[model samples]
Target: MTEQTSLWQDETQSADFAELCSALYEREIAQLANADIQSPQVIQGRLKSLPYYIKRTAHLMLQTQTPLDLDVQNASWSAKQAAHMPLSGQEIAEVNKWYLAQTLTHGLVVPVATTTHIVLDSIDRIDQQNHRFRTNVHGWFYLNDTEQKDKKVNANYRLLKPNKRVMTAACTGHCWVNDHKTNPVIPSLRELLLSCAINWRNFKQPVIF
Candidate 1:
């Protein structure tokens, strides 16, 4: 690398970058929670500002030189796998809907912008080879829509790889996900938010569960 490029890389590898990433991550999640709202339109407006926060958090993490914790490392590994997997638009929407519902259900807030950033950033990181994954959404969070009769159309994610399971979502904007057999339930969206909250409360640690 050229000297200029080398210096930039070195700066990213510094302890300061790690601290910045940690702080940004906490801020992003906390901001989502603090934006709690009942009106979808109002919530949408609040969500509009999330992409900047998400991107900043992601960029800092990618530039950091420190070794990430197991959960984060594993999440990145899953993103790599997902990049290779074929995710249809409908599939993506299904997963996003499930997550949104779960977040609202758990009394945690998530704007559409945040969800888009999380999904797109994971894919972008893999495509650009950024060598980082900052999202925990690695599965299809929807079930097959054809089988539903009432068309209530709740979020049922169908995760691929690691586990080819279906997550039957609740319609009450609650964080509930059960499988077809209801045996091995996937991680609910509420859990993800709670992890983020805990990480923020615990000195702005990196929590991408």
Candidate 2:
């Protein structure tokens, strides 16, 4: 194993992992906010509010993971679904961080040109009408253990409260064979964040039920 791999394995149960997650989150958020900001003032405000956004994202993830009266906002059909997940609480924290990082990164750019257009349009609308334009990332993950050997993980991201929670953008997701221990696909926090933002848009509009 390489030195970096050894370090990753060693830090799986260490504070270093948590710190790495935090750092990665900050970097990802900064990149997203910088890329989408409408003005310098907006960028300044986003930078100032970074901690709040990060904290809110972390809290939401924690809340979703916790069972409330045996109900989770996002849950797999069986505990077996999470079998591939580590049982360690500390490690779970790191995993959650990783998930959130990827989710946020992907959430911002899933719809490609549409995402940017929407953000810019919202900014224009806000400036023109002095109204609030809210957009957020929401999605779920399911562990795939089908007969097929590949695509062991599935995740999607959609616009939150697409229409006052009465409607939402259709989810866009992809499958991956995640085996970080060997031939790690996400070797570093940078890669983890970078992977979240794809060069292409792979999404469809929300379908109202």
Query: How many angstroms is residue 161 displaced in model 1 relative to the true structure, after the best TM-score fit?
Result: 12
Cα lDDT over the full model 2: 0.28
- Candidate 2 residues 52-133, lDDT tens each? 6554433333332221121112211011112121223323234333323332321232221122111100111111121122
What Cα-based lDDT does every candidate model obtain?
0.31, 0.28
Model 2, residue 151: C-alpha shift (Å) = 37
Error of 2 at 78 (Å): 15
Q: Could you tell me which 10 consecutive residues in candidate 2 have the lowest summed lDDT? A: 116-125
In candidate 1, stretches whose alpha carbon ends up further than 4 angstroms from where it belongs are: 1-12, 22-60, 63-142, 154-209
Measured against the true structure, the TM-scores of the candidates, in listed sequence, are 0.22, 0.26
What is the Cα-based TM-score of model 1?
Answer: 0.22
For model 2 the TM-score comes to: 0.26
